[model samples]
Target chain A: MPENKDYLNYIDRTAPKSPLLKNALLAFLIGGLICVIGQLIGDFYQKICGLETDSMRTAVSVTMVFLGALLTGLDLYPKIAKHAGAGTIVPITGFANAITSPAMEFKREGLVLGMSAKMFVVAGPVLVYGISSSVVVGIIYFLYKVLIGG
Target chain B: MATRLGNQTIALDKSVSIINTATVVGTKESEGPLSPFFDVKMKDAEWGEETWEKTESKMQKEAAKLAIQKSGKTADDIDCAFAGDLLNQCISSGFSARELGIPYYGLYGACSTMIESLSLGALAIDGGGMDTALAVASSHFCTAERQYRNPLEYGGQRPPTAQWTVTGAAAAVLENGGAGPYVTHVTSGKVVDFGVIDQNNMGGAMAPAAIDTLCAHFSDTGRSPESYDLILTGDLGRIGREIVINMMNSSGYNMNDNYGDSGCMIYDIEKQDVHAGGSGCGCIAVTACGYIFRQLKDGKLNNVLILGTGALLSPTSSLQGESVPGIAHAITLSNKPGGEG
Candidate 1:
């Protein structure tokens, strides 16, 4: 936009650009590492709760949503977002990571009052969409199950 | 060594003391760079040479005036000068020195320019590089913003990773022939990196780098943390200060006795409008080159370990999702001398 204007063009455009191949590889490595952490959490839940792997799947899914919500509050999602870019951000992991970062960051004020209340300052809209869409999906599943009842 | 300008002669043995220090920020009438794209309308001009230079020159000019007053150095007799600033062409320091018309040199290191310049200046005085050296740093809120972010009037929300660049400048002048609290030693710092790519929160991004450089400076010179009266960092702000404290604590070297930061020094947050705190080349430069230099001259602080921190960020990588690497350099300034004062 500044064209050839020297001092007028004060924009910082010198950050290094990683190749797509390198970015993808970095995303894969970091994303896989995060998945390993998820597997560990799921396995731990199963061993402690005595739930079968199939039943644990539901718990894990719910836990993931909660975890995504929590991490989102922690403000850590940005860091992970930076490392894994859209790969981690597109998944529920980004949601949890996002909420938890801001939540935990502001938790010093008081968990319930500060974190729980206003933690969704930036992500409230996305969380609302995520929940509403899930509600609709649940209703459709219920209707299908009722029609196909044994 | 022989002197072309004669040995730096101390006009006054107890010369140069800090009498007073103050800084002023500009008004909203001075905000621009990203207004067009960010605001779709021109809110104001924040990044022009007029605005940036105004603040930058005002700061350095005031700082030099103060330094000259505190040091008790007559302006007419200040032989050659060693100076530095953060601008690409070293505008603020250049302007200040040019306005005064004393021989000067331009230096840069992002935010570390002050300390880096000071360290070199101390050595210049000690090793007879010049009669007096003044180190300085200044950044406009708009210019620094446009370079690092969208722009102030862009009205875009900023992440917590952001740091407010205070539109101020700081300067210090070290005389080659001043009092004994004059710069005794100035050790060089290595440019080391810790591979931190996320430049969003520069404090966390640059702590490891600062620690690495500090550690190297100490190790290279066979000195310990306890050897200095104060170990200060330039422009790390609050979070970076915490990280540095944590790193130092983990390393089992407590610097709390006299440890401080230039970022934490600017503006009284409770009273002033500085959001998180100061973070610029000028923050530390103003304090050390302005306040601390006087204190050092007055024997208030006998020794100081000034480590200036910097985040190696260009606008391109931040936009492209690359991590920000960081660097810091440490310089030791003490009054102890090989020759008798």
Candidate 2:
């Protein structure tokens, strides 16, 4: 039998490498574009609605999420994501797509069992880690204030 | 009597011919270079089915029916069928068999299923177990994507090594006797894992198995690269094809001129945006039943070796961080029943 370690090394050396520079550039531009759009929406909420800072942030997020879900439903997000890579994924819109895609795909299986149950298949991991990390950080901050500040 | 050559190769005493074949492909495949060769091409992926899975089954059924019809026989004339697909439980082949009402042997060799069915069907014919048998395999892009990767509408970027599953089906009618393009030798491969864990780089994972099988076929048959007019591998994509060529060259066999891959042949990589190239059971199935069969019948090619490569990994296995194991079964198709052309 051929040596597994040697075989793997050969494969790694021979296989074509992904264009890291091109992907990073695309991700930056697309991600910047989405954030710019979000900024514009935030500006509108601040100037026109005269909302508070916290309320404006919420409004901007809601608007962005709506747009993401709408784009996903129209089947245009995936096309963009194909080229955008992490640009589309690192944003809130990516989370929306993650949730909406499975929901759309599993609608055939029924609303509760298919759509609702499978909706978090992709986004679930992100949510679990994100929330758990936040909680840990919160506990650390609480302990720091209680000990150091006291 | 069928004699075992060396370790894995089998030489059938009686002749088993692929009397006829039919290929049915979806829109993307129909737009490929081999578009004109396929028997039936659907205008859309749906093919009037409610779901992608049903569409795959329909394609399989249509291909099977057309193959039987082209062979000048009915479903009743065929004794049994060896069929499979890249779906959970092999549902596509099972549904197609249900419609055809042929005694079914459903297989799951991942992408290697087409040639797996072909090899077994040829054996059945050569063993005098049945006068006629059907070998069919199918895979739909949407079905495979949802099952193996992500949802159809999921917004995710595929890596460069990722392969697009071909949306199509192909069926061959194998009989105990026929004019030409006979199944002469069968080399069933062993599962070889080089500990490749990346699911996207399926070609890398399957290349070792393809290399192992090819080397065995050459040693057992006492033939070299020049023995066959063409050596076609099933769905190894462009990368896998290159690796096989390089490894085989290092092993003292030069396959530079006569080698081809079904994955690279099914789609125009530049135009189709298929990343590495086409994959899945339908990749080799359509290429063999449509393009290779045509070339052999027209006397343009005499001998060809088809190696069906498959990465045997499930979503569960990938999630559990298990390495992907691969297998490749080689079948030699020649214009002459025995001896060199």
List, residue by residue over A57-123, the lDDT tens digit for candidate 2: 9999899899899999999999999889999999999999999999999888899999999999999
What tens-digit string does per-residue lDDT give for candidate 2 at B1-341?
88899999998777789999999999999999999889999999898988888899999999999999999999999999999999999999999998999999999899999999999999998888898999999999999999998987778888888999999899999998788689999999999999999999999999999999999999998999899899999999998999999999999999999999999999999899999999999999999999999999999989999999999999999999899999999999999996353
Model 1, range B6-93, lDDT digits (tens) per residue? 1211112222222223332343212312111111111233324345455566566666665566556656645555556555567777
Q: Local error of candidate 2 at A111, Å?
A: 1.3
Give a tens-digit lDDT track for model 1, residues A43-123.
987998788998887777778778666545454555456557656755566666555554654454577986687567546
| Poorest stretch of ten by lDDT in candidate 2 chain B | B332-341
Clash list (residue pairs), candidate 2: none
What alpha-carbon RMSD in Å does predicted model 2 have with respect to the real structure?
1.5
Q: The CA-based lDDT of model 1 is what?
A: 0.58
Model 1: how far residue A17 lies from native, Å: 26
Second chain TM-score, each model: 0.75, 0.99
Best by TM-score: 2
